[model samples]
Target: MSSRYSFGGDEHVFVEVSEEMSLEAFFKALSMTNAVRDAEISGVTEICPANASFQIKFDPDVIRPDDLLTELRRLEDIADRAEATLDTRIVEIPVYYRDPWTHETLMRFRERHQDPESTDIEFAARINGYSSVDDFIAAHSGAPWFVSMVGFVSGLPFLYQMVDRARQIQVPKYLRPRTDTPRLTVGYGGCFSCIYSVRGAGGYQMFGITPMPIYDPDQETSYLREFMVFFRPGDIVKWRQIDRDEYDGCTADVQAGRYTPRIRDVVFSLEDFNRDIDGTNARLEETLYAD
Candidate 1:
């Protein structure tokens, strides 16, 4: 389907890839936007890729809006004919589930939650048809997730699971936004997962917390030294459940500026993935953990 184009006055143009968010929509938008970037079109100042769409900022004085739209359509046609692959990294993240920090924060915000009586995990497990929280954890940590987009509190990534839609773990956000959320709180809302990069206001249901910092302006930590923002769109992530002891240890390493998240560079083929989801994901796993 062709994209829906809307102009944000004379300076910006928004292209909606699909009415609803899906992997297909994301890929189409990404491919087209990337093509635009590689082409280095004049007057195009910024390209922002979201889950199912992209917005481009441009100077109308250099290129007319209708001309820019025509170029985008032409570029997308070329991009569609090309193979779909991405150079991205697979990262292993350590998550301490059922931690005390998020627990305390949730309790304070009970009135805003769907179930005030149960913890976030318990609520999620119940709604997702898991008999136990342990089973829920197994299901969650069992699969890899794709970083669909990076936004919502700077450097915070929106993750979509690599499983089929029927197998997705879905959860509702809080009834009302919380004034406080622990930094690095692993959260889920609808079908997407996220790690809170900063502590402020949020509505996503908190599941766990990672000791890692996804964003830091100071770049004081070893991991953030390379890039202040740790996550990027198209990055794949695997969750490794950790105990309190391990969490503390990792936190110590982070504070001492000695910790680095385990990462592996991998080329992802969307064609192969769409053809055989399970096989493609398995191959990605092998590439990520190859010894």
Candidate 2:
């Protein structure tokens, strides 16, 4: 649990915090340490359901590699006394997958071509929710996932492991890999690391997508490489599957921008919708001076 800071490279220093470092404590250390300027924290591999750790990328400009190590050591010295006051948040994301494919049909076809029950392709199709995996994720809207890295093709984010009953299996690419698959959703061979927004010749089997533009150069936050990602190290993610109806609903919501409901909108809607019944406030106000 001691702060063990190691130099991963000339530009990046990796600081592995105690598994139990409260979110507040972790951020406090980062802020207090003169070595760390900015940090982009994200979850890493989930070794087990109970034990997971974060892979934090520290900004090397503010903190010298050696100084970072010293500060982390100092933080660890007070680890016992440090109060736990940090609340971690789970970030949910929606993704979609589509192809002229069905798990059953694919299984039958593969069986006709090869040994069906024994083929990895068939097994992968079944266990990975290949047919509607992306659609399913889409329905949930805000399924929690942590953005790990960005640099594959411009704005491609490398995401942490997925939490689902679907076992993370390594599925091979097509005999001739296609150049259109935007993200390579490989869960098995590479331990389920997903590529964000790019398309090129890839040998990894793709599972799903979010067809929208991922990296926008015009935006102020374009190609963000260093920011606090959605998930931390030990957060648990539950993957809920969405049917076709739910998928359509989400698409409709997105088209009208209903998905991005603002805080003010929520407050107004609640008050207006319930004003007559709740009588908390008058529906409208007009003043007449009786001078």
lDDT of each: 0.90, 0.36
Tens-place lDDT digits, model 2, residues 226-291: 432322332323233344566566657655445431111001122232334223112111110111
TM-score of each: 0.96, 0.44
Candidate 2 shows a clash count of 11
Clashing pairs in 1: none
* Clash count per candidate: 0, 11
Off by over 4 Å in 1: none
RMSD of each predicted structure: 1.3, 12.8
Over 4 Å off in model 2, which ranges?
A: 1-5, 8-11, 16-65, 76-86, 95-122, 125-180, 183-189, 193-195, 200-204, 210-238, 243-249, 261-291
Give candidate 1's TM-score. Answer: 0.96
